[model samples]
Structure formats: C-alpha cells, structure tokens
Target: MLKIAMFTLAAAVTASVLAPTAHAAHSRIQFLAPSGNIGCQLGATPDGSGFAWCKADEHGWVTPQSDACPRANVPGAIGEPGGENLQLAEGQAPCFGFVMSQLFFDGQYAPPTLGYGEKRSVGSITCSVERAGVTCSDSKSGKYFQVSREAYKLG
Candidate 1:
C-alpha cells in the first residue's frame, strides 16, 4: 500500500512539472506579411506581439515583446525605416519595463530608444533613452553603449 501511494504521488508531481513544458512546446510559429511596401516578414504571437525581420533594407529587424495590445501592432506603426528602432512595452501600465533595440546599418548592436522617464532591462543590461540618444549599461559585465542623436530623435 505504501509503495503504491508513493508511486502515485511521484507520478502526479512529475506530470505537474512537465505539463507546462509540453504545452509550451506545442506553441506554433505564425508568419505575417502585410500588403504594401513593408518589405518584411513578421512572426507574431497569437496575441499579436513579436518580431519583424526586413530584407534588403537599411534597417534589419525589430521586436516588440509586449503583453498589452493584442490586435496586430506593426513595426511601421511605432517608428521604423526612418528611425530604425523598435520598442517592447510590457504589462498593464503599458510602457513599463520596456525593452527597445535599434537596427544598425553596420549590423552592430544599436542601443534601444526609451521615453523621457522609461527604463528597460535586457538580460543583465539596463538601458534608457536620454537627451544624448540611447544608453545601455551592463553592471555585471562592466559594459555600456551610448549613441547620440538630436533631442527628441526617438519616434
């Protein structure tokens, strides 16, 4: 009786741990290519927030990993092609804990643009857009990136 009870308990615990991973593995990757001069292929979540990679354009790719709006938000709608930047705003407050990344012409890591008082985190790197363009710092690794643009340059 004891062996049976222990076996049943262990099986239940294992099932609980593996259920979420199984469900996540089943997530589908959908592609979206809108009509017009967008010149990009977007991969979005079922709730409508993901990434876009453009081909043969000065700007490379942009990703907005947010959990707010769920109705087909595009990179052009924010500010792309012209500014070559993208933002990821999360949570109910909308723009809080946002992470933005800019696509550089030289295929380098461009610091993301932030709002007047917005702060963002990408892994161990924390960044923000100030009057001097976008500045990112990784305290753990003692690394940083700062790019300067005109005031109010971020769109």
Candidate 2:
C-alpha cells in the first residue's frame, strides 16, 4: 500500500483550486490503449486530493532518476529509489521517479480502450489517445505528460 500511495504522489502538487466535490472518492476514470501497450489512470489520491499517471508495457526511454529522490542501488542512497514511475498532478509539473507500483494495469478492471483519436477525463485531468501514444494533462493548470513505447515527455 505504501508503494501504491507513492505512485499517487509521484505527480503530487502543493496546491489546487478545484472544488472539494470534484475529487470525491471512487471518481477514478481509466482506460487502456487500443493495443494494450499502454494504460492510463486519473483519480483522487489517497490524501483526498487527485492525480494522474500512466504506464507502458516496458517504457522505452524515461527521464533519468530525479536528483531529489533518495537513491536506490547506490552505495549510499538514502531511500529505496529508482526512476520507474510516471506521475502528474493538478497544479504541478509531472515527474519521473521511484514509486514502485502499477497505477494503471488492472486485470479485473476491464478498462475500456481509448482509440487513436479518443479522449478520457476524470476531474481536471484529460487524456488524448493517439496512434503513437497517450498524453494526459491538467485542464486547469495546463500541465501534462506523455507516454509511449518510444519516448515520454512531461510538461
């Protein structure tokens, strides 16, 4: 559970102006890419706030491990860490870091597929699915991220 919470916090932000009712529990909305090579999820975090993230079958290239994170596998790293997650929050920029959990993949979910030109939204985050990959972003702050087998970008 700790790891999963970390996954939700991976894109955590310090502030938000969205209404409280906007993030009510069980409001999660998620979908799988047409090819199932990618999955995306947007929902309220454990803290009662909300976030969005996605995962790839085996991401091709990701941002190098963040400097702010406690090192993992390093001789003197402070915490169990590695850049293995992609995260996005409502008011902050996305991040790549150590949050060892699968936020999107779910065998029992039967999540619908976002076709090449479709879109999905939950709260303030909206995602667009394209033939090449998926891009999810905050509608309020205009922050967002992208994920694909070939590459990723967080803006």
Candidate of highest lDDT: 2
For model 1, state the Cα shift of residue 152 in Å. Answer: 16
How accurate locally, in lDDT, is each candidate? 0.35, 0.67
Mark the 10 consecutive residues where model 1 has the least summed lDDT: 90-99
* Total clashes for model 1: 0
Q: Clash number for every model?
A: 0, 0
lDDT of 2 at 123: 65
Task: Output the number of the TM-score-best candidate.
Answer: 2
- Work out candidate 1's RMSD over C-alphas: 16.1
TM-score of each: 0.27, 0.64
Check candidate 1 and list the clashing pairs: none
**Candidate 2, poorest ten consecutive residues by summed lDDT:** 69-78
lDDT of 1 by residue, 1-116 (tens): 99999999999999999999997743322111121111222233455433332221222234334444323233334322123322222211111112133233222332222345
